[model samples]
Target chain A: MSEPTPHSMSETTSTTDDDETQRSTAADPADPAASADPTPVPGETGGKFGRYGGQYVPEALMPAIEELTDAYQRYVLENEDGFMDEFRRRLREFGGRPTPLQHAERLSERYDRDVYLKREDLLHGGAHKLNNALGQVLLAKYMGKDRVIAETGAGQHGTATAMAAAHLDMPCEVYMGERDINRQRPNVFRMTLNGATVTPVTAGRGTLKEAISETMRDWAGSVEDTHYVIGSVVGPHPFPAMVRDFQSVVSEEARRQAIETIGELPTDVVACAGGGSNTMGSFAAFLDDETVSLHAVEAGGADLSIDEEAGVAPNSASLYAGEEGVLHGARTKLLQDAHGQIVESHSVSAGLDYAGVGPELAHLVDEGRVIPVAVDDDHALEAFHLLSRTEGIIPALESAHAIAYLEAGTDTEAGTDSEAAGDDGGEPDAAADDSLGETVVVTVSGRGDKDLESVIEETAARDIDGAPDMSAFTEGI
Target chain B: MSNRAVSDRSGNSEAIAQAFADGPAYIPYLAVGDPDYESSLEYVEALERGGADLIELGLPFSEPIAEGPTIQGAVVRALEGGMTPDRFFEFVEDLDVDVPLVCMTYYNLIYQWGETEGPRPFVERAAEAGLEGFVVPDLPAEEADPLREACDEFGLDLVFIVAPTTEGDRLDRIMDRVSGYVYVQARLGTTGAQDDVSDQTAASLDRLREYDVPKAVGFGISAGDHAERIVAGGADGIIVGSALVDIVAEGVESNRSTAAVADRLEAISRELVAGAERGSRARSTGDPS
Candidate 1:
């Protein structure tokens, strides 16, 4: 009924807050409909990635978030107290830095392109999650925090965070969705072996989203003594930026190796996008490289469309078909309803079943700097067996989404409805993409040791090409 | 200090201050539609019948990170009962309660409502539906300008929380914009009932002595004893959420009738109201309680 003061579209923090006086300023009280190019000044923007990220948490958490924002600025950005230096040193010695970039001869010959694999699977916890986990746990130590909490969907992050917390000798508790705990039992055992308590979250499908909410609820009370090592780049400010900065070493090393090994930068850099930690990590250093196309492969679980009435997205392709909405603190591309309720997302791989993606990745996708593609369970399962057989590498089902895209490409003609290419039926998993260029870098985000049971059942259920004979598994592996 | 939220629409906005003017206000909260729409309306009206000075109706949000297990359960039940923002407005219209209603929820629902962006649409709908004010958990002072402006435009009060840890420049920022009341968190945690009233409640109330708004303490306040302690410690109002929700949950679990559950809620509300009044009597009569 009345015209309110038009919130300025630009970063209004510079006017309302005394920027020089303190770095612990709150979210901008002005325009949330951020402009096209959200500047990367965390201080001024309060951690917005082009209107996608900000502090959307309770006031009880404001002091804790502000303290974290201050710590992030001083330690992560400014390298205060030699935080970055020590972090890198521990990452190299403890977690194994500069994981090799191996050229895949079998995949290269099969695809007629130079396919290089960034061996993050060789890292200590067998995934890129440790990169951020170690960084956050270390940051907590510097901030005098005595305990650390993390949420996991696949147990990759949980195991990695548990390992980091154990190595740091800090008490750690991980919140795993009850369903994931039942599925990823081995990784759960590994976390327990690492001396971290795993708490099962039983709310709302018991997945990454619920686990994250549970962990945030814990942090709301225990913020003084504990640090929440958010496993992905999806949460509020400082988390997305901090986790990205920590995991960016994946791309930094890959970028250098691509130049040195290939004698030029690769034409494409591919990584699987879940909550988009690995995707953002692998794409961080390559964002300015126009020649290098960054492909973020999302899990198209069962189908691409959302069941609006049922409130279920049969896929986790937030980057591909999501609308902007807030889920876990940050406003990002999410598989939500028209009413802004976050719908349940599905994926054969627990890691990629999340409904929302990293805010920065969402911004990049909208800006045309990154490309998102979805691979269904059938194709991803085949790719898992293909990689294990061809290259002797059992890629995680989450990582297999990338390999599936590498083989089938994004042209939906090669989908389950394969009549587009006629009855002649092209290589079911080998639909070609000539634009992937001469050299391609795919990040093997994790080893698939944890996904053996799921892969066997999934591969057997669908007649996935290249799946190993299941006769021996008739009696159970 | 400026008495900004004085009311014209049946004195609804001014009713907030009046709720606390008599004595310590007994504010009880419940999800808008926990078990079902009809029963929830009965539960709220039951609170009014039981001597509730003010009421906080939770607009069920999917990701309520600020809530603990109890309130989170209530939100889930409410959402499962086909509760949406539009449905909540309709609920308010159907609800025949005289206690001033404050919508407590997250920022996304408010920001994403109606055709155009910002809080105007939701606040307009809320005001039109006879809501007095709002208590958005996620909308901090830094990100509170839009909501504040919209509330000011529609003559609804915008209340901010002052946590036990809140102080220094941040506290000043919150105090500058807060109206109707300041929700003083009794402890540093998510909202749910606790066994004992926090010792920090008195100290937090003392810290907010200079602010010129009704200071309602919430978080971990469950029993009538908590109300007494908080009110005796100089709190203007006591906000109880989880304890009442627990009764509803118990009623649903035990298969009690709507009237039975409503009767239990009314009894608890009376107990809480009496507790607060007792503390107020002690305060004014110079009793050393």
Candidate 2:
């Protein structure tokens, strides 16, 4: 069972029983052990994932957050106006849900284990971002909101939110860091084509952190008519629990598919974690299964160290090297300095270039229920090439972090995955992991179409062992 | 764990209360080390010289979500000037102003200040730095227990902002944790200068009638007339931020001397204070702005 929050923020439901959630969903008729929905029961944890989550926002946002919290309880939890039912239907018809769980035959042979790919990459808009975006946009409509706003890092969430907004005919605006807009130009084009105005955030490092702050500033002013659909499960209250509920369909379906295909739950479930929507979603249903080992891979940009004088961290591995701190509305593991100022995080993949992770994921890591691993840019790049050549699928750079973990166990030059996954506050190279077992399921979080430019540019700069011949394409293709 | 390092929390709160006891409390805010450390210190001193009551020294966090471009720009300048939490405390200690000073920043800086865990370490350090209280924009009362406990232990006051939308049970919850003066948001948005006074101010102030805390209005109180209107609408005090910082930004942009910038701030502070006093007299005489 999930632990109680250190401080519960429930005045309305404080008198209610802690065991009974304000609203509980009907159990899936399938495996009862896979129903580990940690959508913080109000009055029990409020919005906390232990000591990490709360509504750490300005007073101006309290009304909106409370309204959203109520709407979350009604529309999302109780399925009022058939909101969730409609959301699920849209996922199947519009977002292309129940994406295939393909057995990577070649990858299985290479890893000497049965490797299954939970294909979120095949979802419409080329990523798993649509699940939450579509749900939140729909929730906004149910709550009488006329407009939507969001933040994006790699532009996947931006594109997905833009697409959902267009589908629902709601005016949409997406705030993206200026650097990310320049790097992820194709995705920017996608958002604009879907009729969403893209606002470039020119603050602080011009990355996800800046974009989120900008979006929040906009929401603070326009919250009466507009809903800020947070891109990940990192923000205040209801967003984390609500987004997890929306995205948990990933693990729900993956678990059922694994049972149908391989007769039981996979021994390991791996996914790359940035703000941890996909990671939490993929692990939510498997959390109750004692035998299932969950692995969350993080981007290790260049190295694991930070430049104190420069206030810049070389990597985005918060779980690997972070202290407990509040960032982006929640207290979670963050890449910060001796002083509390958040350091700029780096990663070759724009999606994983964030200083904080999901509060729930941090709690799970602290509980020793989730294994956190880091894959440096070089290894992630190599894994990108390896997956494309071996599986004929060019994975997004974020997903390549997970793909790299598989190789870390076998790749001689690359470090072992076991050693990287250990967060015992010791040397990272001193851990052991011999229980990856037979069947492993890795969620391919997104397609690499938006990453083609980054891939070509990065591959040309480095000597990736299995990268395609780039002599003809190196001259700015 | 130790109160020896902390000044009496009531001493600062009493100072704040004493400031309010005389006339309309003129609270001015500026991010510490906006352009440079030396200039920021001068600017704060100028506020005190201009009849300021309590002062808010912004400890710039890397990400200030509640700030508009004006204050965001100020934060950017302060951060670029190498303003860390340690530097902020040092800057606070350096301020020679007589008014009780409070630190306004995000919760991250408070939660991660000291070598040990939790807000106690930060609160102890803040109390030692001669700060009276804090005005963290991001910390709502729901997540304020730890910080509240820390402030109580340190004898510092914990302030909460009550926006126009706050009401009923939620308002009660916030009011319970509020000490020092409550920051009454004059409008429904982030901190910035605006053309007209918000009509929502009267209703918000009226809702807090039952709460005995001092109501200091802020947000969009750019000019002296704005301050007058807010105080006339029944606020115990008036708080101004971005408009003053805009002058600082202009000074930095025009490459003006510190004296010139600080002189401009002092003039505006006097205007705001005079206007608030006029409103206070008008309130007693039953006149509207």
Candidate 3:
């Protein structure tokens, strides 16, 4: 009954990393997250950590990406003290950093498992997207790029990019897919109000790919004068690498706090994956530690059985239906056909709507260092509501996918309706104790403010229906 | 087979089909993601009304490679207006402009769609939605047969291009098998305003005429003057791209206030049409042609 006291909700999945620092000044020990690993990070500038974060761009855009890399390096090198001080200051004051490590007391008691959350939702911009956007925009300013261009899927990146650009007083342009524009209208309006030009792409299937293509086109046309700020850890070299480096703040903090609070490292690390930002950010530091199991849960919209979207089927399944090929200028697993043509990608979370993962994460997944799991939209929704009801914390729909994986415990049947309510109409609480296993920690990446309407509609519908319909929706193909 | 017929309902099918039969090369270009789909309908209607002789509707891919800044800005606007292949087809279907709507698009999109997998379903879907032809900017004349075959089966024109950089044997081959007018790249660049119409372009037109094809010069023929000079230089048709894209730009810039910008664009289009008509008349007479 007293097994580590089931880990206080705040101490469920602790990550205890060594405090040793790299000897080289090219490495910063004050930035403990970036200091944990001693391996060659991966790419040319930093260790690409598996080919995930190389600079894969057109020949014309290389100079721009390199310029950004160089500027970031120069800023980090010359103004280390100033930059880190400002980074930490703004992150705390402006970005609302050091978001609390909240213990889910009620959930821990109800499920008989310690469930703690690293609440990133408390960050400004309502998600973890700002972590990198702020870093990159500041780097762009340091690089002397007068303007920035970016692509958005559900408009989270667009809004974040616009916000960062506005704060920096740099002009911003966002390329969005036509479909995403309609689906995420409010974000579009928000970006426009923020003084960013919203260019709707009217080609192919109006989705993330179109948004990415248009971003590339815009960058190609203006690579000389603009910085193309990518949203996630995907894209070719440097981008996947750079975004992770910036977002690594999440894991860095998580690892430090885990040791400081729990006196050890966590047994497991879990986060959601759209373009795999939070997951990568949460797991990058712990990658080489063979003891910690890193889990990345992808959206399984309605049917957990299916690997892709229903109506608009795509060929990409970097984790499930992809092969190792080059796409968007980097060599990673691509969801392309034999001939290398891109196929549509599907995920419940707008942020995870990409067909590929960050190259570094892909390498880790390929090497079996990290475990990959898919959670359908319906279950993710359940996790979303569960976290809200249990902890009074509403997480981003994207982050909910990861929570679903932790709550469901890798067995699709574990979180089923029959398990929740029981076959003979027994009380729902009867199976609660049986379901709880180990200390479960979920990364609440961002606030659900952006997804509040959708969550309300989903929960309202579920309340009206009396139960979550398992058949009508489950994470599937 | 003169490019003088003007009827919104009819793009003078008999003349265009005859021109195809005579091996008259054609180059038709329109901003793919054009004036609002509503305005694109009008521009397509105008091309039909002006007897474009052979129509090329730019596919308005999210990434347009052959556009200058003016056309590029309009494309950005069209994309903003929810322009997708499905919506574009819907616009084409509703427009009721009966002409060979050759879809001028970039390569990556078609490649993404797996052109070899018979993008015909998409093309047929568009054709069913009332489109008639395709001219992907990146589809070289050498690899044009499959697209040509798909169009041929559907009674559509699979048009090809002859850039200024196109050489002798390739030129002769493109001229020989090209069905719709051979898309004559008037300049060494994308579709937009040019400083001046080159004399070398005139020489290229003459060289093309020697192949006995009705050649149409495209890329940057914007104003009435440019149209007149093109028609005077032995061009049977003057295809306008960014000029049309500019009208679209004007309409979008005015918060999409249709009437004023549409009227202004209509007038410029009419002048170019009239200028082309006059040049055609002069050439027929061999007097001031």
Candidate 4:
């Protein structure tokens, strides 16, 4: 066999009303705007985050997507008395709505900045995931779907979904990666106790990506009476927008609290980006406020800076290190190889171990509305311990990444400095202080209870000389 | 030389139009390089001999979200057998089949091959490898303009899927630039074997008939009976995927020979072809309701 030239092939192929059709329908290649802005606008009618999110699913699931989109628009977004009221009631009654905006006095003094923690960690199910779960479960009820399916990474979302489903008396199935199931055993047990059948996904590095693929396949197979309660602001159109809308309450409350407590809007809002739910939620209300800087912390995993030996930064910082690609039904910044196959992301926190960031976050990164920072495992672990010691809060490793951002000094990019210095009780490098202004709010996405085992193992492995002894914390259980 | 002639006859609009012109065509799907490469080659040949009008060669990706368990298992086997894009194309280049071969793949594979600045290289490579078109399950029309332009430039057909839920302007947008037959899913689920076709299948096809393109119904189409019923419902062609993948998977599980797998696939393909013919005849004679 010989290679055929493209010119020869095009010449010989049949032309079936080509010129007429081409003229009528072909997209104009000359138009720069058509190709320039790849990210979809957030909250667009069709679940677009500029151009990043759209329904890129199988044909079989199109009806379900449409049905869900229709229901979301009709009963949730537009319905004042029916869907929204019930969702608010459930969030208030069950999910413990309006989680406090606590002044991190001790942590603030340590860093020489007024730091506040958006206490989603204090909410029901011990995370902000309950907010989305409550809202989506209410939407499922409105859509008359009796069964709910979800995919979880750290199991916080799964536990939250299970709680909501149990509260609604709906059967729930949660798909979790085998690795996550092992690491997040506490949350897995919580989900099981809530009556959700947790199916362990063993495919594709056994992480959030695989769990999502498995859950999507399940949704594809059972779209009629089942609703996929996507844990984050990811997946196909409607999901990213819908989840962001549900979690937007986080920022709305934070904004109001900032005004009431701080006497002014926050100078900077920080949140970790793992599929970017909390980040989008915390940043959504402050998007138009140019004065309020938005900082998104991605899990740096081992290291994000260029390492000579590895030849690449092994990190989940898609906005910083990844390129545009489609994953789990939406086009977003993905941690993909040269060949576009998704590379495995490593993070101490399973919640941040995702190859793709949410489309809305990707859009914000493009627009420069959100500054993307990647926090390394060591710094995140340091933040995890520092919060526990100073603030008496054991933050989820995912949330620790956000605190690591502040610890690293807001001005400098995360994972840039190799030295771990936050726990020395000395002020962070003066350079670090200049970048992060006073009055910063970090979204404490979840409590660290589900991540205690992984944290213990990681902390033990690090064995830093000045690290806080975690022995007392892990002594009992 | 015979293979060259077959390649020349395929990969064009005329061939696909001709296949559907006679009657309702039977298009059988096989995950390329499943079980092993050589076995997959034999399976393709058997499908052609078994009267397949068109063949959908599935290039298995690491994650096939649109697929059901049967196709997913086949993909796992294919990947385990080391079926990379280069090997998949090499196999296609060597295949001496007569039927028009449309590659079924995810968009990422194509996106990965092309540079960020230029026309997609995958479309050019696919044309050179003797593929007629693409059936990217994940590339919706909204995100499909770039690929569609590449396909237009490469002289390849870009098939679009019309689901039961696709209506109003979305359906129009999908059908607007479709070069090959439109893929009509039988139900609201992934590809798998089903006992009966849903009533929505008929309605979907009926809705699609207003468009000028030929319609091929797939997803959950398992048996010859399904083929018959779907074709009778006015589909210009029947695309059977998971059911055929299951046969190959069963053969591999049972440790059957490559020829045994080929033979089994051939038998099933023949049965489906017969059913398509019967359904075509029934439609022509006004015997189908």
For each candidate, the DockQ is 0.50, 0.63, 0.04, 0.36
lDDT of 3: 0.62
**Cα lDDT listed for each candidate:** 0.83, 0.84, 0.62, 0.79
- Higher DockQ: candidate 1 or 2? 2
lDDT of each residue in A122-180, candidate 4, tens digit only? 99989999989999988998789989999999998999999999999999999999988
Q: Residue A308 of model 1: what lDDT? A: 77
Q: Pick the winner on DockQ between candidates 3 and 4.
A: 4
List TM-scores for all candidates, in order. Answer: 0.90, 0.92, 0.58, 0.85
Taking all chains together, the TM-score of candidate 1 against the true structure is 0.90
* Interface root-mean-square deviation, candidate 1: 2.0
User: How would you order the candidates by lDDT, starting with the best?
Assistant: 2, 1, 4, 3
Candidate 1 residue pairs in clash (backbone atoms < 3 Å) = none
Q: Indicate which candidate wins on TM-score.
A: 2
Model 2 misplaced regions, further than 4 Å: A1-45, A411-435, B1-12
How do the residues B1-289 of candidate 2 rate in per-residue lDDT, one tens digit apiece?
1243333332336666777788789999999989999999999999999889999999998899999999999999999998888888899889898889889999988887777777889888888888888899998887788888888877788888998999988888887788888999888778998888788999999998887878999988888888888888899999899989999999999999999999999999999998898888889999975
The candidate with the higher lDDT, 1 or 3, is 1
TM-score ranking of the models: 2, 1, 4, 3
lDDT by residue (tens digit), candidate 1, A1-477: 021111221333344221221221433232222442234442233778776788778777878888998999999988999999999999999988989999999988877678999999999989999999999999999999999999999999999999999999999999999999988999999999999999999999999999999999999899999999999998888788889889989988887787668767777888999999999899886654444667888998889899978889999999887888777888889997767778899999999989999998888776666777788888899899999999999899999999988776533443332112111111112233433666789999999999988877777677767677876775675
Native-structure RMSD, model 3: 13.1
Order the numbered candidates by DockQ, best leading.
Answer: 2, 1, 4, 3
